[model samples]
Target: MTAARDDHTRWEELAAGYALSALEPADEEAFLGHLPGCEVCAELIADAREVMAGLASTAPAVEPPASLRDAIVAAATPRAGLPPSPRQPRRRETRRSRYAAVAVVAAVVLIVVLGVWNVALQLQDRGQEHRLAAAERVMACVEQPGCRAIPLAAAKGGQVPVTALVRGREVSLVADGLPPNDTTGTTYVLWQKTGAADPSPVAAFDVTRDGVAVIDAGRLTDPLGTTEWLAVSHETGREPPAAPSEPVALGTVS
Candidate 1:
């Protein structure tokens, strides 16, 4: 029993890492391998997915740069010339060899340029994701019906106030006062309870230095038919136990 409990705890820690996209490739693969058989871990992943969906929804939409598109197209096109390889001896063998060397050099340069361009595209995508997340939080109250806004003040000596919204069938939780997540193996999990039998999962998210996040609470199922409390907990793993540490924010759906 002790060994099983230890394993469960380790798995939970892995679940949290997976939720935050902080797991290394190998660990992520292992976590995925265990996902099919672990209901607790699966629930954690589902909640994390909700948080990711909210983040994606809020990310700013960006169009690809014209130059980037053009460059990509040009790179993909095949040059209608001899392939870059040794050419048979012709009348001017030495000159032909020199030309071939230059061609090879040109191809190498093109490859480098394409690689740099691809990196730039990826960076742009990351920026867009950040912008969109911020925008999504700002627009939450307006976008979903039955959503009411609540201002969460900082605990102490904090500057930013978090704005959260309760809307039809879900809650839009956006905050800017939390500390940046710097730990190598930790993540935040969100939970919702109706003061009934059990607390339901909401989201598992990675908090930024600015403590900004947009948590999504989809339609919840509670015996009490009420959604009243929300909480955040720090844990490791790909899954957390069913219960949260403590209630961070409390409100009602109505």
Candidate 2:
């Protein structure tokens, strides 16, 4: 089971093929047999496979044609009719080709990594934009006539202060010392109550790291004059609930 030093280049190519799952049956068998003995090829395969793992999750799904596999096998397979070249020149050429092959694999993996990172950054920027838009809405509501600030009392006598800003049908919440909504399938829900009727769901919101949120609660079932009270509840799901599972704060409409 001795591998000639000169065959390292061929093994490197096979290692890449093994990592990418593109090797022919014979090549795969030979590479597996060689892998336990050759640390260099094992490392190459490990690095390439790590890159392939990331591609599986983030890369768009595309089915390559059957001919593509045939082409790759044909290209990777060394020609049978080649004459033996000078040892010194072949060694030099092999080193260059080996580096080139490794570089290509690295470049492709780099591109995919950058693409995923770029998408994450874009989503973050979009979230910031939404927060800014919500802030602007709160400001707009504040400047409107008939907008009244109502301080919400904590249901359990906690010191966290929550305020409800109401103008006609539009409602916004300004709060401090609220906890983060990290629980799965849960959200902060704003509910409005009129007279003896059950609380009606208004809107859902998210709190920032500073425990503050300027939530634009959309519209109410009744206008500001008719609304009896407003309450914020921590509830499951983004959809408004029929009843509050956990009432965090409440404000009486004056």
Candidate 3:
């Protein structure tokens, strides 16, 4: 099909709908043809398609009868040009047939609802799997030899109970009663001080309002047992600082 050359504005307006596969056939064909030559249009369409693909996994899937589609179309458009309606089935015992039709409609609704519920459960299960993996890391550290449960109490304030689980270099901290703060430009920096030597910076992480943080500070430069003190400090994000500043919370590292 020959592609019509529309102006940039028109193309941009149609790009998202085409990417989402919601555009009608003629528009889809024309936009697809235009996409190859226009770099800007191609990139935006690619991004939109990716967003739609990701959204598909989260949204419930239900294919209603074709009549539903037709009804929506008929409701939106002018009625003058509509074709004559086809005759619907007429039953001799109208009362009983109406009851049967109602039963069938209820069944279809239930099936659609159950299908959506199943999809929701699957998505939730995937999320739980990730959380469980994080939890297992902490559990493994606790169960390992030379594992240390370090207390992370705030130095200058009424502290919420926080504990760091460490085995070798792997570390995960779980804290409670965390303050709700905008994490936009802030992070929790971990510090390791080996005896009197300068405190060294390790991993940086963020916590939600619920005070939950599972940071994999990665492997420590020094071996697990060598560090004398482990601490966490609230600092500006982007990158971790070189030296340990003041501690938001601190505990002995054994």
Tens digits of per-residue lDDT for model 2 on 45-133? Answer: 77666666666676553333334335444554557999755456544665555555555555545554567678878877876775676
lDDT of 1 at 206: 68
TM-score, each model? 0.38, 0.53, 0.44
| Top candidate (lDDT) | 2
Full candidate order by lDDT, most accurate first: 2, 3, 1
Task: For candidate 1, write residues 78-113 as lDDT tens digits.
Answer: 367946444444334434333333333234334545
Provide the overall lDDT of each model, using Cα atoms, as 2-decimal numbers: 0.54, 0.70, 0.61
- What is residue 214's positional error in candidate 3, in angstroms? 3.7
Among all windows of ten consecutive residues in candidate 3, which has the lowest summed lDDT? 69-78
Lowest summed-lDDT stretch of 10 residues in model 1?
61-70
Best by TM-score: 2
Ordered by TM-score, highest first, the candidates read 2, 3, 1
* Candidate 2 deviant stretches above 4 angstroms: 1-10, 17-32, 39-90, 149-165, 172-189, 194-219, 222-228, 232-242, 248-254
166: Cα error in model 3, Å: 2.7
